[model samples]
Target: MLYSDIADVFDRLEGTSSRLEMTSIFSDFFKGLDPGSLRKIVYLSQGRLHPDFYNAELGMADKLVLRAISFTAGVSESKMDELWKKEGDPGKIAETLMKNRKQASLFSEPLTLEKVLKNLTMIESAEGRDSQDKKMKLLSNLLMDSNPVEARYLCRIVTGRMRIGAGSMTILDALAEAFGTKEDRPDIERGFNITCDLGFVAETLAIGGVEAVKKMKVTVGNPIKVMLAERLPSISLIMDRMGGRCAMEFKYDGIRVQAHIDRDSVKLYSRRLEDMTSNFPDIAAELRKQCRAERAIIEGECVAIDKDGNMLPFQNVTHRRKKHGMDQAVEDYPVKIFMFDILSVDDEDMTLRPLGERRSKLNETFGLSDMIQLTTMEVVNSPEEGEDFFNRALGKKCEGIMAKSLSQESVYRAGSRGFLWIKYKKDYEEALTDSFDLVVVGAFHGRGKRAGKYGALLMAAFDDESGKYCTVCKLGTGFDDAFLAGMPDMLDEYLSETHPSTVDAEMIPDVWFLPTVILEVVAAEISLSPIHTAAKSIMKDNAGLGLRFPRFTGRVREDKGPEECTTVNEIISMFEMQAQNKA
Candidate 1:
């Protein structure tokens, strides 16, 4: 198939804000495409060559993309820059210039989807001294053969900014509509959530149908989407929800990492599936040294420690994220991995096992070392015992406690949030029990000293049911001048030309962003609002939950993904907790 068919679908998607329309449009096209070509087209639809975990980059910066457009369209570089100033989107600029190219189309070869993928793969692998030139030449070579529509998509894909307005969940909806029944959606989603690869899932579904996707299992190297915990108001509610008996573990104030260990290899992944083995080489080495099993997938928290081996604040461990001065950073931020749960052991999936059984296997798989140890957990049968454990965790400079269900059905549901596990933090009576991690979805232009930068950012919480981010607050406080000035550079990847279709916000801001950056935010109280979309119509008619006097907590949760941010259900629970406290 031609790449233009994919480009045409992207064009139609960009022209609409309705997700149902986007799904219908893509579904219609996907119904006719060959199964083998589904992988490339699916990845392109998501504006990527690989999944979120893999780190293949095309190295095409915005200026380089404009130069490539100038090279093949016969438009001067300065002229293309002028057009870019008028039209913010480089894809549009490429489209307009390629249409009026000085060179005739008769000399150009037909652009095929296979050719596009090959060039992109070469561009990703291009490195060394001549990489920048090679990337631009490869991009221009594609433009030389591309039509106006194909040129637009090529530039956008290379630059890593496709404004087609469809997210992964939207593509999932389209796939289900195209090939499988509505009942197959959950099984299809289970496959993706387990493997963390949408392209593979799409190809499997397209080729062998839904049954192929159902047969997918947990692989060792592939990072599983970490299962999440829900939040509750108080200890009594947790004990009541868990039938008065639960396993309480210390909620360490550190980075949540998953370690995949084999015979001689170890891979550590963050909550977002970022390869963090380089970030914490010591942790990787320790996990490898201490593992007794031939292969195991364990979850842990990487906590920084001081001279006396006491736990330090989460900010101290953030220094390890730096690429340079790693040897010195390791000496400064001496760390330990507190293993909590094991998902797989020796090629056998342990996620289906009950929590108690999984915990037992985790204990048996690894010998305890100074750097690797199991989390402190205790079984409690009453609210008083749970409260005492929570206090002890705080006394150890930890966040709070995690209460997990001890029932036989308490299996690890990857990429899910439920009452099987619940988190309770300190300050239960002071509005929200813990800080909320929200995604920056939109921003207002600055004024006065903050001029030419963002004044206030529109933050939103993820609505998992709808797969949409709903506005909850505007965060303008707690940012110093340095953080303010560096905001654009920090949030470069999420900048959007228009409001993303996956975001639901009633208030409009000067700039929009795709949900990507996660920030830790705190608020005085949760209140009902007429404009915000979070928890809309859940508590009352036409009123959504919003944060009052929300402020940044000076912590950028680089360890979390947008989907892993605080959810709409969490905000609603906080609101109810506040109400209960007042009562």
Candidate 2:
């Protein structure tokens, strides 16, 4: 296929805002492609060359890209820099320059899809001292033959910002529409949720249909999306939700970890599916040392501990997130991982089994070792018993208790949240004391004491149904002077001048972000608002849920990803519970 055809689709996607229209455009583009080319096209459209877990990136810096643009398009470096400052995007500047090139290259030729993919792979593998020069030349040569519209998309793909509204779900929807009927969407999505590879799933569906997609299994290397739980207002509510008799486990205040173990080595992943194996080398070593099974995939909590074995706050483990001095950090902050659930053991897919059986496998595969142990759990039949368990957990400095159903249907539903598991905490029965994990989507400029820096941030909750970030509250309080000063260094990596396609908000800010950073926030209550888009039209006609008097909790929540933040349904439940308390 010609490169211009693909560019036309993305260009139209950037201009259109409605998700349905985006799906239609992608479905039309995906109709007549071969299987291998379909896979590559999906990855490229998502601004990626590999799956989500890969650590390598294109490594193209804005300054280097500007140099390449000026060298190839015959624009002055001064002019390119000026345009970059005003537009804040490398792709836009390239689009403007490529429209009127001052020089024509001798090697220019018509660009093709294969040519784009091959050149980009070469750019990604470029390394060593001369990598920057190599990247500049490779990209400049590609630009030498690209049309104005094609030049826009090529630059955007290299920079990892396509500005297309199509998310993972959008692509899945289009694949189902193009390959099969709407009934096949759930199976298609299940394959993606299990494998975390949409490109591969699209290829499977296009070639072998839904049955082949359904045959996908939980592999040892590919990380599955972690399961989630719903929160209850009280112990009685939790008991009622669980059919009055359930199993409860201590909810530790630590990092959520999912370890993939083979006979030899082990890998750890955060809740957002990021590779944390290098950061927690000590934990990785422990898992490998204590394994009793040939192969297994388990989930747990990694908590920092004192020399006396007392648990530390989640903030204590944040130091391990640094890129350097990891050996020293491990010595300074020791950790213990409390194992909870098992997803696979010895090549058998344990995800389909009941939680009771999964727990049995977890206990059998790895017992109490230096850094690993089963989570503390018990069976409770009444509210009184559940409350006692909850109190014991809080006394041990834990957050609360996780009440899980003992029913036969209590299977591990990966990448989903529901009432199969419920969280009962100290704040639920109190005056809304539980802090929320929210993502930063937009920010406003500061004044007076906070001049020349960001004063407030527009926060949002992850609406899983829509795969978008919806605004909730503006966080301005509970920030120290040091945090205020370090805002730019923390948030500039996700800076965007155009409104991000993944975020849905009625109110705009001075600056927009790509929803990458997660922060811990607390609020007095939830209220109806016209400005915020969270829970929009779900409860009321036009208003969405918003937080009243929201404040930061002084923690960055580095362990959690933006998609793992609090959800729209959780906020709506909290709002209704608040109303019930008032009555």
Candidate 3:
């Protein structure tokens, strides 16, 4: 297929903010693509050359892209830089400048999707001396062959800023529409959840049909999407939700790691699917030594330890990820792994098994050692017992307790957040029971001491019923100078000219953003307000719930997506609970 065809679809998708329309456009575009090229098309649409787990990025900086655009458009670097400053986006600058170029290439060839994808792969794989120049030449060749419209998207993809407002969920929706019925979506989602690769799933569905996708299973070395937990306020509510009996495990405030062990070979992945095998080589050696199974996939928490063998906070363990002096850091801050759950063993899928069965297998598969042990847990039948366990976890310097369902149907639902598990943290006893994970929807300009930085962020809660983000709070406190200074670069890709279709807001700020980044926030209380849009008309006519004195917790929920953030219904439930307590 011609690359221009894909570019036209990108233009249409970017012009509209509606996710449904974007999905429809993507579905139609997918239908026209060759089955063999579907995988490349999906990756390119995501501004990637491979699945996220592969992590082979284009590695093109803004200056590099600008240089390539200038080389192709017959413009100076200074002139392009000025245009970039005014346009605020390199993609747009390329589009505007390329259309009015003073010089034209003597020879041009029609660009194909295959050539574009292959050339981009070469750019990514380029290495060693003068590699930057090689990458610039390759990108310049593509720009010379591309028209102004195609150049716009090409630059965006190279610069890692394909702002089409479509994420993995939207692409899955499109894939279901293009290759199978809507009823087959769950199977498709399951395939993605287990394999953690949308491109592979798309190719399988396109070439081998839905049955191929349904046949996908957990494999060693491939990272499965980690399961997530929802938050509730009190032990009574947690016990009530879990049928009065549940397993309570200590929630460690450390890195969540999934270890894939196949005999002597072992690998580790973070909760966000990042490869961490090299960072935690000590843990990998420990797993290889202690794991009894020939092949297994187990999840655990890796906590840093002090010289006296006491657990340290998460900040201390984060230093282990640094590239330099890793050996020294590992020795300086030794770590231990507390195993929690097992997903697979010897080519058998355990994700469908109940939590009780999985826990049994986890206990049977590993031998205890000083470097590795099972998480501290207890079976509780009442709220009082659960609260006592929570206090015990706190006494051990842990974050809190995880209340997990022990029902027969409580299987691991990968890439999902539901009531199967609930997290009760230390802050629950404060004004609010749990801190909310909200999405950043807008930002207010700073003044006075905060000049040149964002003063406050407009936050929102996800409404799953309507698939919209509703404004709930304005978060301005708790962010230190470092965080404030990094806000622009962190949120640059999500910056938008207007509110996204997925967002519903009452008060506009100096800037809007797509609902992408998730932040943990705490508030003095939940109150009804006429200005906020969250839970509107449910509690009272035309009044929505808002956060009072909302402040950032200095924690970015990187493991979560915007759709998985705290929900409006959860907020309403908390509000009602608070009112009952007052009564």
Candidate 1 C-alpha error for residue 143, in Å: 0.9
Each prediction's TM-score versus the true structure: 0.97, 0.97, 0.93
List the candidate 3 regions with Cα displacement exceeding 4 Å: 102-104, 462-470, 492-506, 513-517, 533-544, 558-564, 567-573, 580-583
N/CA/C clash count, model 3:
1
State how far residue 256 of model 3 sits from its true place (Å). Answer: 1.3
lDDT score, candidate 3: 0.88
How much is 536 displaced in model 2, in angstroms?
2.8
Q: Could you tell me which 10 consecutive residues in candidate 3 have the lowest summed lDDT?
A: 574-583
Worst 10 residues of 1 by lDDT: 425-434
Which residue pairs show backbone clashes in model 2? none
- State candidate 3's TM-score: 0.93
1-583: candidate 1 lDDT, tens digit per residue: 7888889889999888788898889889888988778887888886778887886677588887887888777777778879977776778888898888767567678889989999999989998999888888998888889889998889888877777877777788888999897888888888888889888888889998999988888878878988888877789999999999999999998899999898999999998888988889999998888888889899999999999989999898888889799999999899999999999988998888999999999888899888898999999999999989998999999988999999999999998888999988878746566789999999999999888999999999998778789999989999998899889998755677777878899999898898888899988899999999999999999999999999998999888888889999988878888898777
Q: Across residues 75-190, which tens digit of lDDT does each residue of candidate 3 receive? A: 88789878877776778888887789765577888898888988899999999999999999999999898888899999889887787767788889999999999999999999
TM-score of candidate 2 against the unseen true structure: 0.97
